[model samples]
Target: MLEDQANDPAIVDQVLEKSGLSRDDLTSATYSAQKEALFVRFACDVLADATFAARAGLQFKSSSSLTAYISKYSRDLKQVLENASRFHGLIDPALMFSLRVAGNFAAIEAEWKDASYARYHRRTEFLLFAGLARLRDLTQSNFFPIEIRFQHEVGSSRNKYQRLAGFPVLFGAERVEIVLALSSLDLPVPTYDPKLREHLLEYGDRVIAEKRQPKQKLRAQVEGLITRSLPGAIIQSEDAAANLGLSARTFARRLKEEGTSYREIVEDLRCDLAQTFITNGMPLSEIAFSLGYADQPAFSTAFKRWTGQAPSAFRSRLDVSAKA
Candidate 1:
């Protein structure tokens, strides 16, 4: 991470405030280092732009890591949308940077699945409303027009939509998107500084290029292996590497070059699977079997270790908390 505290002070402040954490929370030497990963995950969860998170110095092992972070931090779909709204001002800039980065990254496909594409559209809607709200407060502009581009067929929480954004909402158009006039994008942020903006943009470009380099082949391979290993599929690191057309030693070497390891990737995938299953109310035994655990007891032990609670207890707590 860059040691220069002056590069993007506004962004740094925003990240700290949104995360409810301070710089010392990240840098305190006596703190358990493992907690840092959780903080990084929190940062990723609230930031609409992945590139912006990277520029803020949160290192991720894969795109799945980002998804997992969002899933864990967001208790429900509404919470996810709310956080997306809070970070709306940063989304446009972040998306612009992401587009540049995605163009350079060979592994990222140009097309998005319907579910994935809808997520971005919804996020953009939240952003537009939040941006307009900010502008309204700043300039007392009551005439700002807000338009959303998702169709009624695209299912979302209608109650929340009506409650949070009271604007002219349109659905089912030529595009699954939201549009804001350039005037909205150009609204002056009270904290904005030209030099800091330039620095962040440059830093974002650099980080994107670094992530796109061929040296991160192991990172890509691990992501592919995790994606391929569906429920009931047993995957070994050596086998995964072989499937990637590389020897185990070569894969390890490449991962080292990318500043991560096979074990880290495996652990990340397991955590992701566990969370998804828990959230979806899949049976513990079934989840264990799906992840290739030998038996229920073994799976329970692993779950306890991972989250400090039994699967049943976790589910019970989630249910109780949801009611509260």
Candidate 2:
């Protein structure tokens, strides 16, 4: 996967814009930067397209990534695995990783729970494959995992999966996994640099310290909940709070501390979603229903308040502009 190197930064930036990320957010991110939510948003955009979905696994060079610095100090593959696992958590809480002793084969397992692209297993597999590519570069070895497994049906990226996994990809499993012989885990990494090992560990510590746990951010959690339910279900503050295992009062207080409220978030999201639905030519009535409005009139009033024009007028203006 690393060798194929499918890179299109423009496409990524376009998707990021649609996903409500600013230019500064993209420019500031590094391999070590905490990009948990950004990645989830990117996966959703990539997985929506069948042809470009496989390229979801393609990232910038593994050697330049923060994971590279973290694992470069390992004396052997085992230490590399340990250090990699430790630092991976700081990157994203949505992804779970574990190494299990399964007799002679050590299983490297990754799981995504209620991930943004939850139903799209291709997104999950591609992400894992991308991580594996980084591991391969870190180890600087010719070895491959004995088996690679995924829980989703094979898609267009089957051949790419085979090439990177060094084994046939298996599907219809309960979880995603990679099987490697225990001996492979004991091998020494060729790129080990003793001079920079200690310094890199110190650098890794600073990176981890600067990252905030996504779960702890109430505003982000609320936004995610609102996004996940959009064009599908009505998101009440109570329901959103319950989903986070917090009481409404507690959730409200937390959101207040973050300088926002549930009503404010819902309104912001509805306005953004309105533009997408309207631009796509969805009927105003349908757009209203999708945004969980009781009827078209209610939504229209809100739309006028949001954009200084009724939904119909706004859409008609868009049409004229397109034709002109």
Candidate 3:
């Protein structure tokens, strides 16, 4: 990897010199997350554009890796994406990325775990399309998303961005994410092989069953399922477990080991989302409806449980504060 990247002028050469990493280490050694982060920062300094990451995403294929083979033959787009999210750490352990569905849309959200890679956030978000592109290739389907979004501002030319993605890009969103219609996520990948995909999934199950679950990753997987399910479907442990192909009892036990519960995670996400909508001045009823509440009264009851204040009162205080 280092040999291939060594001659790339878009990345600072000295970073490799100072990194104590040689081409040999790329073959024989593992680097820490911080080392990986340093390389990205160095790239930010030397690279003229952020789309490099996005462009790199198009290079994905059913490579020699078992994961890629799993991805290549996946039965559906959901399996391809779920497996991608599961093994994405192979790209960079310092990055946290998820493909989540909610309401009428889905989003592929990403962020650097280290604050130091903050400058690379936009590039990371743009890579969503690249992932989409690879998915299109793997499935041999032309699946264009409804919209693309990023938290950071875009300095790249609009025409160029459109050309690369063949889609519109929107910036300055709440999170570094790319948006897609929920329908897009369900489309079958054209090249899907049921037998290979099923065999891989089953083999995956046996492999994981033989090992101890990694708490942080298991939490992120559950969180992704919950995030996708919220504002539309009611989140239940059974449902999340099903999504993960795990038994409900196993899911609950794992979550307990991770020092959290399904209810707690749901409440945390709801409170955060409620606050965001409230700050944006959305009506209580509308917020309630969007948050999957049947009626304002039930939502208000839940809001008070989440925030110790009725949603109306909370909005009223915000209104007063804004005026003052």
Evaluated at residue 239, the lDDT of candidate 3 is 82
The per-candidate count of clashes, in order, stands at 2, 0, 1
lDDT ranking from best candidate downward = 2, 3, 1
TM-score rank order: 2, 3, 1
- How do the residues 1-324 of candidate 2 rate in per-residue lDDT, one tens digit apiece? 211222566665665565566558657764222243444435433443222333445442355556667576677877777776666676555666777877788887776532433333445655666666666666666567877786544333356556654576775466688788899788787777877877877887898888775444676567667755655576788999999999999999988988999998788768866864564356778778778888889999999999998888886776665455
Local accuracy by lDDT, each model: 0.46, 0.65, 0.63
Which candidate leads the pack in lDDT? 2
The better candidate by TM-score, 2 or 3, is 2
lDDT at residue 213 of model 2 (Cα atoms): 57
lDDT of 1: 0.46
Candidate 1 clash figure, as a count:
2
RMSD of each: 13.7, 8.6, 12.9
Each candidate structure's TM-score, on Cα atoms with residue i matched to residue i, is 0.39, 0.54, 0.51
Best by TM-score: 2
Clashing pairs for model 3 are 139-190
